[model samples]
Target: LFVAGPILLVELYPARVEFAFYRMSLCTKLGGLCETDCLTFKEKTGSCRADLTPLCCRKGKKH
Candidate 1:
């Protein structure tokens, strides 16, 4: 049983890591930072597209 647990975890690990990257890719592609707040210098709060969570995007100030 213990050996089986290790094997299962190893098999599932790559898929879990890949899913994380896929989720982050969408947020990044939309030019958004997945942060709790958008409070920063030269940053504005905006919505993100194709994101699973409620993403607080920090957008740069337009010149």
Candidate 2:
């Protein structure tokens, strides 16, 4: 018999709202998955940042 392991829960958001502050409010209720010690999602904003880009996880790197 095969057993399943813990599943990774990923949340999907609309392109228009992914990095919006309003949507971030809802994330707080979800325990803020980005609080992990590993890599995390950060809102990329401003001229220096890429618009609507989702940060990718990297190995051997501390968030």
Which candidate achieves the best TM-score against the true structure?
Answer: 1
| Model 2 steric clash pairs | none
> lDDT (CA) for every model shown?
0.62, 0.34
Give the C-alpha lDDT of model 2.
0.34
lDDT, residue 52, model 1:
57
lDDT of 1 by residue, 1-63 (tens): 989999999999888667666755766776767665565653634444323544547567667
Predicted candidate 2 versus true structure: per-residue lDDT over 12-61, tens digit per residue = 33443454554444444433422223343443222211234222222332
Candidate 1 residues lying further than 4 Å off, grouped into runs, are 35-56, 60-63
TM-score of each: 0.55, 0.24
Over 4 Å off, model 2: 1-19, 33-63
TM-score of 1: 0.55
